[model samples]
Target: MAQHHKKIYPDVEIAMPTRPRASLGLENGDPSPIRWCHQASPSLSLIPSPSQTPIQTLNLNPRRCCCKCLCWTVGLLTLLLFIVGATAGIIYLVFQPKPLNFDMTLSARFNVRITTDNPNKKIGIYYEKGSRLSVWYKDTNLCQGTIPKFYQGRQNKTVLNVALTGRNRYGTTLLNALQEQQQTGRVPLDLNKNVPVSVKLGALKLRKVRILGTCMLIADSLTTNSLISIKASSCHFGLKL
Candidate 1:
């Protein structure tokens, strides 16, 4: 018989008993309350969190959002401009101020005097610089000058005086015509004047517009240093933008 020797096991390597093999029904381990709960719990980790959701999955489109905002802003600005333009149009229509009416008081050799009246009841006229005053006989422009800028009140009249010199080329012809007209006792004259003006209606003031006046007259003579008589006179008035 072989003699059996007792082995001392202290500090010697000992193999651990093998764990029982998991049942076929259990994937990782034996079933337990904790384990079943952990397996059955909704897959919160697999489901994306709000912060971790894919950018493409969001309902918003960045390009479309920007386009919508831009369209709204442009539409609003267009509406505002339309309203402003309509309001200005209405104001212009309601305030149709009359132009200035002018008449010649004195027309002597190298001297002219004019008087003007504002016809509108509520409209005031403010004349700016760059005015022109001229006299004509038939097709000849005899003299040219400038009128002083001034403001005319409603239904008010203003007088102006100017010294005129004839054009060098036409001085002799103009003098001959004047002498002939004096002998015939009937002289035809044309006067034209233009000035830039601002119109005031009530408390509202408008931008500058041009005031033009043309007068056709039948005069008795071209007397020097004496007031000439006007037999008949007709004037036409207009405004230019």
Candidate 2:
């Protein structure tokens, strides 16, 4: 019996227990790519690739964004224009600049004279070149002259003198009328003026405009050497744009 126990068998291989494959839904015992896919739970979500995303979600929506920006820009410009218009209207209403007031009279010697003493404290006048003065009796033109360009200050008086040196073809008739009027103590004369003048408000000078004036005067006599009295005088004023 001692001899039998001492005897040993040749080296033998042993087998180990394997994990269950049914949990992974694998028909074969070896691991595979399909086996890994089946190993995940059905509730797990799949991540989408960059190219597979929806076009609507990925796009920047340029049309809507540009429309919003354009609308805002237009609104701002409209508001600015409106504000400017309102401001200009207010300024025009507040500062209404007007032409100078003129008073004219005819002398006994058929001379035309004009005087301006600015009645307004805030407005001034600048007389430009090409100003004209004329004297008329009915349809007859008696004298014509030009006024020297000058600036007239506010509340300051300016005087212009013009002589009737021109003689018309009907001078004898005019002379007779003048003599008759002088003896009758009443002379009817018309004074007309065309003046280019710029208006001023405080220190700002406006665009140049044309002033037209007409005056009807009655004097006592036409004597050049004697003192004369103007009995009645009326004037009308207009401006050309």
| Ten contiguous residues with the weakest lDDT in model 2 | 102-111
Q: Please, what are the lDDT tens digits per residue for candidate 1 over residues 199-220?
A: 9998889999998999998889
- Superposed on all Cα atoms, the candidates' RMSDs to the truth, in angstroms, are 26.1, 26.1
Candidate that would win on TM-score: 2
Clashes of each: 0, 0
64-100 per-residue lDDT for model 2 (tens digits): 9999999999999999999999998998899987789
Candidate 2 segments whose C-alpha is farther than 4 A from its true place:
1-111
TM-score of each: 0.49, 0.50
Cα lDDT for residue 241, model 1? 98
Full-model lDDT for every candidate: 0.80, 0.80
